[model samples]
Target chain A: MSTALSQKLDAVSGNASGGHRVNPGELDLSHKVILYLDGISVSFDGFKALNDLSLTIDAGELRAIIGPNGAGKTTMMDVITGKTRPDSGTAFFGQSLDLTRMNEPEIAHAGIGRKFQKPTIFEQLTVFENLELAMKTDKRVWKSLFAQLASDERDRVADTLQRIRLVDEADRLAGLLSHGQKQWLEIGMLLMQEPRLLLLDEPVAGMTDEETERTAELFVSLAGKHSLVVVEHDMAFVEALGGKVTVLHEGAVLAEGDLATVQNDARVIEVYLGR
Target chain B: MRTPLSVRMFQSLPRTAWLALAIFAAIAWIAIPAAHLLLPESSPFHVSAYTVTLLGKILCYAVVAVAMDLIWGYAGILSLGHGVFFALGGYAFGMYLMRQIGTDGSYGVALPDFMVFLDWKALPWFWVGSDSFLWALIMVVAVPGLLAFVFGWFAFRSRIKGVYFSIITQALTYATMLLFFRNETGFGGNNGFTDFKRILGYDITSPQMRLVLFGLSAALLIAVLILGRYLVTSKFGRVLAAIRDAESRVRFIGYQPTQYKLAIWTLSAVLCALAGALYVPQVGIINPSEMSPANSIEIAVWVAVGGRGTLIGGVIGAFIVNLAKSFFTVSFPDYWLFFLGFLFIGVTLFLPDGVVGLWRKLRGKRAIEDTDTPTETPADAKGASA
Candidate 1:
């Protein structure tokens, strides 16, 4: 047991040599798809939240999922992140890891990071501590109890602070940040894990126009390095992402293509973006 | 080189806290014992035996309160069954104390008086090692710690939390209390373990012995406080607070909440057990009444009244409420319950942060007024939110 743990620790530390960003130890992306879901269905009290929802996100590809209220956008994110178990279907990450078999933390440990619709950073902790808590270090009880942040880990956190534009507010309590700032801090927290796949739920729900544009830019920049599945209601933000868009009407995909292509689709127009 | 444990333990605390702790240790270890043992009986400054025992008992309770704060205040697990752990600790030590009676008991048999009264022929399998002080000390921590670990494992794995968790814990202690009340349980039934003659061959009721026990209790309380402080301020403590605030969020960030909760829960139970073990010797009795659900709720009340999250607040709260209880139970025994109820309600409603928070607030306001600086408003706002 001791040898097994030490070997696991050695593997993790070996991967850490690349930089502060945790390399998830070479994901088996030979299948070309980072995430694949087919015939996924989740029902709550006989009401289908996701029904036969089949979608695949390619490696390092950015995808936007847009839909009306109760259209299963958040449910899809939940299913992908292992928050909600699909009643029937296959959800795979990196061809081998069955996401359906995993729990939330396991899914997260499998290099899938998620941002909740509501900014849920630790409000009681400082902005720096918030990012520090999210760092890709040992999550075991004893390890965390004795673990100190290495200089590289500190540098990574400092870098994330600048990326999230919260450098000035690093020492401030996270609860005191503006709504837009809180959103960025939460994103920064996700980035600290150095996930292979990022699932964002309504990244710009309450952001101002400028904030929304900046978030779009952030997503665009993160796309090639990280697979991003951005679910949003803002059309301009989707266009700004300049990626394939998947539209959902009920629990299934209504249309799939670019923003203009989806906008022009008749079924998409009839159920959503009414002409 | 890795930092020493001593430095790491005191890293989060200011220098004044260290000084305060040192002063407290000096008083507890030296001054109080000196007053009780060395000072002239006619001297008003001399500490009385009753006072020593009372303070000693309260110190044990303070340790329990500190334990309570760790799980409830930091980990967001409200266990109302902590009395089970405390009583378990007491029973473990009580077994040794009962053995120390050593043919001096009522029936003058090898067995305890209660066992002889029940016509028990021999010690139960569970009581095999009860005669050894070392074994009893091990039981004091292990029994409660093991129970907590098993209970927390099942409860946390099933994701039982919030008021449901609280209710189940209450049920746990309630059931244990009922079980311990039965004569067949071999725990002295309702009377539990008492009538001790000696501990380690020292006269059990000696003033010097009492002072030694008192000193041990005080030292344990201080140790627990420092340990609790170290834990709550470490990275582990930060994650614990995060779990308290948002459990699901912690899960999404790749942390197993159950493990964290279970670890702290077990640790807290062990602390409570240690407190209990110390308590039995000073108080001279261990009974099923300690496992009563009401007793466990009182433990929560001490943490709540003291200020839950602040480590020191727990010790302070334990001292304040127990002191009040000691005073009121004697002065107005009939109205003591009413006073305690009012105190709990008052703290919950008006002083949500407890006495510690109230102190900080007054000092904060005074500092702000004295400085008359506008820049301090943001800092105050941040403090208030945290």
Candidate 2:
């Protein structure tokens, strides 16, 4: 009945969509880099959360960032996802699109999705509905009112439910799910967005060993199709992911190598492990 | 081949819901009107004029309750400024009613008595088109819709939410009430608009006109329910629920919470304004007091008493509370406010999900027991907690 939102959306899509469109051509990863952060520094109340931090992720790479508390891991995710603006930094998605210039929804629309540290699935909604809400589609206010689930879209939800091992629990409210199930549901929701890069913060914090192993397998399998930047504190899960581990300390990278190599580094051992 | 519009509309509601609607329509459109207009005064089936007017007023309230539920229940936005929208609609239509008084006012002038009494030379610019019924109808929607859109745009854009949003809305209505109470604003001052003589060249107080307003109110409530049902059942509804639960999660999934919230908020306001327009013709008064913060709070109470997310709950709640109000104010006028306070407290304390949720829980438990399976225990537990 009201075209107010449609008009605003028209203005937004007209004014902001040009530079931020997610067309594959503009997402050019010919250099093989999916994410690039250079000289990023963020300070709050004069305490540096991130100082001169720079990192790069190869296309479709699963990058595990291991850091102690206050290592700027979450802040880094915030910056890339456009939640927090860094005081100084150039963050790029692929090569053409700038992450710092967009808002959270814009960054998400541009193919970057972030999962919070805690499991943040829509608890009141059924697992199926949660996935449906998160599914990649025209999310405009007016369009959503008449949107019917296409057969292919329904199949996509079913496929995701199977992949996330929540097929049996599809009808159940997500709040009723166990902690690990909620974690998986949140991941399934992220996958529904079809994000090019997935930033997961401590995704396996409360999972059982079996669930943790399963999640690790899922993340490993997801690599090469979806670039994952998993910020995890669980050493075992990180080891299970078996990807490149970047150890962060004092707001900067302390070590960069395989898990074995980082574990063996003298400085890494002194600051994080040797203690 | 696309489905026919009528067939699709019919299929929107389940058979049971349709039956319920049919029963309601029969009473509102056929039974009650027949009882009032056709039955002799001595007949037991004869409905009194006072009762018809009261029921008509409640029906108007029912429309407002449903609108409140759409935003507060479904969108998780608690707006205490909704009375402003309702009052705005009433005033918009009231202007037309005043103009229709023609040269019959005590001042014997073509201008409304208030304008003549205030020594105003002519109608205000805002009331220029107030003589046309079509203009009144347009203003009924446009006025509140515009206000809500502007207010909601700024509020939602700044991400003001939860209790803060509620407080701001309360302030909004309170301020509007104060503004309307001023004579300088040219809206009849504290007396507001009343003593209407006619509408569309027909007697406003005639039995036929009263029944017409009553039936229109019922139709509006029914339409609001159907539209609300269609909305909350769509993907948009699911996204709204998701936004309610986890707004940031919705943002990360690429949906702007502000746009969705603003759209629903404005729609809810427009619905309330329509209810108010219908309300003025039946109750025969439109005043600044209609925009009072307390009146808006009572609306939330109706939704909460019925169940927030369930559209039917708001209607049931409006009927329950208003009927109770009619009884209490007549019998114990002084304690009516106390009774309302206690009712709200009781509903909030013991019935968090409102009456509809309680009904669902009772039914769910019975079904669970009938099936009797260990796998259903979690669902049973969820019902209890929910």
Candidate 3:
């Protein structure tokens, strides 16, 4: 598996000389690790947002990262998604593509999809269109000008609408959707991308209890098919995710284990969950 | 699956839209020209040259309005400097018209009167191929398209958007206007280019030429409407609207908003340039004032008044506003500016969706389900901030 991964990386680096067509989204998860960040450090205007943040997510792993405010959960996601460049360290998708070198669109095309803390769907477009735009396809300007949805693509969109439970609201303007529906629609958009890694920030922030449970179930079902990294403040929702929980504090990992184990850690209690 | 371009273009508009276009084409190509040329001067149906020129001029303005709408309305990039592209196109074509004068100028020195007056020995480097009609046509699209491409590339890459983008565009045109006003610029100084004798060896001032130019303007407007309709309905247009609403979101979704914005921005500029090229021959004048910031702002007003995002709205808006301008300027010249100011204010407050939206409401029909209306979307809260 590692040999296959190295060959892929070799071909990627030698692409100019080899004159090979570089197909995106063919991420090398042969080593069973979908992501890697080692000694990553980022500072903003003299303030360190992330310091020596090292983390890894194995393929098909479901992990929840929780921390107090300004603990760098979002900053980590930003670094991973190429929104914020790190001052130092190595961040890799699979084993070859450097996260630090790529831009947002490049990173996204590399099979990493992020759902912001606030649902950021295209509000002016219809609900179905939001998913369509997010679909994994040739998104070039000239191509999009004449793009017509293939039967399979349309079926996928319809399928995503059902999974996200927005089938009824598919035709409605996204702006008119309720908050929970918008969240689902956004998730549906992510699903349409068929990403390898899903970084969800506060996915259940404003959802009702039932909606929150449904979202939890959806995330659980998505875990084996896609690696999930969720950053959330809701302990109940995190507990419902039922996965290895990582505690972040002051821009670095403080504790990492099962939710119960992390909850019992003294340092985690001191920095986050208190007596 | 991609459909053939010709098939897609033909099917872009509805049958009703096609019918409307056919009627408009009949009037412009057959009726108006016949009235101007075939009818006797004493006949009521006789269309005077002034009326034909005025209508031709409005048709040109309508094209500008649609081009403005393509960028500002659908893409949400309000450029208050489209006048530069329009004027640049005018200057490029106007150069050809000036050269067509040969030695018929006041000095008869084989040079344009302005160049002779400035005591210039030869044509400037930029005017080397001014005599070639094909070269002028190429320059008409190339100059504005290149400028727009480069300008849009830099501006969009830096993520300049919203009101800031609007301000810079205004500044761009204002600066261009000032530069053109200089005697050293070689574009006929403040007077610009005028006093054309012929085009392609045919007398330009003849009734035949006027009708030809007028017909061409009408044809261009129809073509623009069809093209604009094709664009806004395409998946590409949906992406444009999406970027307008949430640019950062678009970036995260694996689509480079800069490319889309730049493509549309440059295309819009080229469209405006085409309109400007048609405008110069019909109006018989191209001056530095055409690039004024105020003129650019007026183009936005036409799009706004017509109801943006709907291509047809731009045509209606241009006719309505320019026709009103002609009337008010002739009758109550002093009050025209004030009236215009009030018109804009009133439209912003009461007719937020412009005349088309109001018409939709009055008819008890919803706006074309697909027409993107800024006010109706809750998108402003997020609005291209990233």
lDDT of each: 0.86, 0.86, 0.88
Q: Name the fnat for model 2.
A: 0.85
- List runs of model 3 lying over 4 Å from the truth: A1-26, A273-275, B367-369, B372-386
Docking class of 1: acceptable
Distance from true position, residue B383, model 2, in Å? 30
What DockQ does every candidate get? 0.45, 0.49, 0.48
RMSD of 1: 5.5
What value of lDDT does candidate 1 attain over all alpha carbons? 0.86
i-RMSD per candidate, Å: 6.2, 6.2, 4.9
Residues B81-147, model 1: lDDT tens digits: 9999999999999999998889998887889988888888999999999989999999998999999
Q: Taking chain A of candidate 3, what TM-score results?
A: 0.90
Q: Between 2 and 3, whose TM-score is larger?
A: 3
Q: List the RMSD of every prediction in angstroms.
A: 5.5, 6.3, 5.8
**Model 2 chain B worst lDDT window (10 residues):** B366-375
Q: How would you encode candidate 3's per-residue C-alpha lDDT over A108-210 as one tens digit per residue?
A: 8878999999999888888878988999888899988877666567688889999999889877899999999988988999988778799999999889999
